[model samples]
Target: MINGAHVIIYSQDAEADRAFLRDVLGYPHVDAGHGWLIFKLPPAEVAVHPAEGSGSHELFLMCDDLAETIADLESRGVEFPDPPEEARWGILTTIRLPGGGDLGLYQPHHEPAYDL
Candidate 1:
């Protein structure tokens, strides 16, 4: 049987990134060993997208309202690379990570299958 998911975020500044997940985003975590932090994420779902070239899997945070979510995160000092773009699936945007990367965020327009 399947269980919970574990996500690994690679960061240029791993400590700062860990701090962001722990302090900024307020995700509960435990120091496994030697200051290594492991975070617990909220409920999640996965999708498979066809790769046109050399690609990889990704992690995205979904919200009910993109604008409101963006505003709240901005107040917490988070930055976005650009405005949200609308697509058939949702309104999508990139959230700047603490170290030197970005994470995907979206407000889905389709009926959620989270209850499944």
Candidate 2:
């Protein structure tokens, strides 16, 4: 039986990213070994989308309210490179990670599977 999912974010500055996850986002994590921290994500869901190619994936953090979540994150010193845009599925924005990468954040317009 399937139990859980483990997501990995490859970063140029792994330590800095780890600190951001720990101090900024406040995700509880356990150090695997020598400071390799694995974060405990909130309830998660997976979906399949059609594509021309394979071997690619994405990660997006869901929120109940985009504006409120943005405000809360901003107070904690997080940055969003762009404003949120409306989509058929949701309103979405990208969080500028300390590792020089972006993580998707969105408020879903459709029912989310994580609740089920």
Best by lDDT: 2
How far off is residue 75 in model 2, in Å?
Answer: 1.1
Scored against the true structure, residue 70 in model 1 reaches a CA lDDT of 96
Per-residue lDDT tens digits of candidate 1, residues 1-116? 86777888899999988998898889999999999999988778888888989879898888999999999999999999979999999999999998988999999898777757
Q: List the global CA lDDT of all models.
A: 0.90, 0.94
lDDT for model 1, please. 0.90
With candidate 2 superimposed using the best TM-score fit, by how many Å does residue 62's alpha carbon deviate from the native? 0.4
lDDT of 2 by residue, 3-62 (tens): 898899989999999999999999999999999999999898887878886757899999
lDDT of candidate 2 vs native? 0.94
- Where is model 2 more than 4 Å wrong at Cα? none
